[model samples]
Target: MRSLTGFRITAQRSGVAIAGTAAALLLLTSCAGSGEPAQEAGAAVAEDCTPLHEFTTIEPGVLTVAAMNAAPKFHALSDSGPFTGIDATLIPEFAAENCLEVKFKPMTGAAAQLDLREGKSDMFGGLILKTPERAEVFAQTEGSILYETLGITSAKDAAYDTVDSLQGKRVGTLSGSYYVEPLKAAYGANNVEEYQSDANAFEDLKAGRIDAVAWQSIQGFNFTDRDDDYVTKILDDDQKYPELTVLLENNWPHTKGNSAMTAAIDDYYERAKADGTVARVLEENEIGEEAAELYVNGR
Candidate 1:
């Protein structure tokens, strides 16, 4: 008998012609499903025929993953080393399955996309939106690994509730962020102000240069906590933005080669959903309350 990954099979003949014929016959037999019951057919086999673990045989390599330094999601502490949010925990499991290694990089909010575009990073794992325009530059994975709700924040004395309310007021946001589009659509392109980074946007917002700032709920809350003068408020019903997706860079200016990565990402989401790991991560982080519930309930 011959052994491959601990599986012992009769070594009938070790010739190219014999191997080819055996391969064809095995394919044909597999396609022709036996009429016997599955349990009965399995019981008839003398060898222990259970399939080997699917993940162990994949090729091993290092993959660079990028993320913006956002707390409770993806961030680095000078003393604590690099860490991830829900998406981060899944990376090790995925890598173990694929026999790959991961190297994490923290890019500024503005430079994250540029890093991927220049081939400096293999993927970004965070709340990235998949826009048609961006698809030209990168490939997007199927389904959002997490959901983010947008919120508007202002001084406690500021009065605003709806998207129309922000019409003439200056709104601050980070450059190259998904919030830019929604803010532009709601408050006219000119009314939306872009900053180089989230810290800069928060600074401008605190300086009274901008009437309000629009960002993810977690970030909005974090900003408010960091500054005493700022007040965080969830955007009104009319101002809420639709859910967006995270995208990964593909082999662009070449042929489309990120299909495999995209497929793997989709499979990751499916497994995460089935096992409730997604919900657990959200709940542990104390963000995305609604999404966590939906994921936990198997929605």
Candidate 2:
């Protein structure tokens, strides 16, 4: 027992020294000072911070944009096999800025909103109006992308002068559109004849089955260009149609989270508005003389 205490104390001191050395090594490694170059350590920290930059930037996959393909505003070509409109022009620019590829999907009738809600498309690019009900499912931009004036198209010799004047007349409108409510309220639901498409509605107006057709002024004017049988006049005169904007939902059914996508889109829209790309697209699509004014005034 004479030397047992000395041996035990020496072994305990050796064990404590080894533990402290291991702890020091760990601290040095954590501080990135384990004999590694400073630049390499900085790079490792940067790689960890910017995780999004690691993905392939080649295409960023496809962003499907839904359109009604209604001509002057939107149209899907059979030969081209896709849609084109003011939205078509602007979307590519927006996509380019965000490093994305775009694919256009043409839809008709009442399926436009359904396609977006069902996650069939990434965005809806036509002249969709903003409403409290619509906001429940979609996120809208702060300012309008463009302004469209709703008007009535009638036969050149028709006698209607005001919305009230068409109280008993048959008015053609595209079914399930925001315009339906106002037209039904103005002319009574019984007097309003609903059409599946604007093309058919314009056709009926030309055929004299309907006394007037309600449509966007610029779009209706463009339609009249294609067919000379009708004359277009502003319906409300004060240009009260809802402001058209690009639409994207808060959450798409296909994605688990859309915060990053929405942020990218918002940044793209802001930059486009600042650099005049948006205005150029509107002009190239022949929106109207009043488009720039309307956009600036937030109407």
Candidate 3:
């Protein structure tokens, strides 16, 4: 058995439904065509991709991408088709490069991974990252972004700063996130609480239900930047935590043994990296180099 290479991810927006009266069919069709291109956040002009010409995909000449709906990164509006974010926006480049049409499907985390395994989708990506075990089952590309854990607390309450300080209080983080175990280890299992989404965790924090919210640095920054009621803080300076960093890799996965598909993904990643596409996308999304440095270098 291979890595299964699939696990849970946090939600950005609720449901796969469009929020308004978007032209459902037209949007889907337009999203698949060449007329609507991916966001021009990357510097590279992707060259023609021909690997899929002979590759085995669920849909003939169409690249089926299984993704979750998340705002500012990927969105499948109520009926507006797929728009916004890295995965949704990158459809055109995949289509143009591979000489194929693109189709984006919204499904639960388990279902999405199942789609890739069953060949329902050519690939899938999101808050998903790669592990050594997963690599055995699915070939992966380099991570486009980095991830590190941090803590957030209410602005009115400055009682908590580090994990040790929250020993007697409740700490919140997204359920099924990689940070869960590490946080539990740092703050004690009895003190940890998990939420369905970032919004939920922050809601608890602002309401003073929890002493602090333990989460990835980006997540901590993302919400605090939006509402001044909360504040962001780091724990890398603490001596107790030495290896408190990881990169949240968003790699596309194909079925096991699909060497051609794997090669295509890796090749594109190299080109995309060299062209500054990765950096540009992160910048546009407000994931600055400074934040990434904090994760990698722990500065």
Q: Pick the candidate with the highest lDDT.
A: 3
Worst 10 residues of 3 by lDDT: 1-10
Winner by TM-score? 3
lDDT of 1 by residue, 107-208 (tens): 555566776777766665445655566668777765656544455678867735555667789998767776788678767899889875556677777788
All candidates' TM-scores? 0.66, 0.67, 0.68
Measured on C-alpha atoms, candidate 2 has an lDDT of: 0.49
Against the reference, the lDDT scores of all candidates come to: 0.50, 0.49, 0.53
In model 3, what is the error at residue 71, expressed in angstroms? 3.8
lDDT of 1: 0.50
Query: Candidate order by TM-score, highest to lowest?
Result: 3, 2, 1
User: Candidate 2's residue-wise lDDT over 1-299, tens digit each?
Assistant: 00010010000010000000000000001111111211211111221222221223212444566565566455554323333455555555444333344555565525666666676666665666555555566655544555444556777677354666677888887775667777877678998898766667776777779998875554455565444465666533423322211111111111214546555555555555676666665566654545344433333
Model 3 Cα lDDT, one tens digit per residue, 76-161: 55434545555554544555455555556754344566666666666765545555555665556554333344545446347355
Output the worst ten-in-a-row residue range by lDDT, candidate 2: 18-27
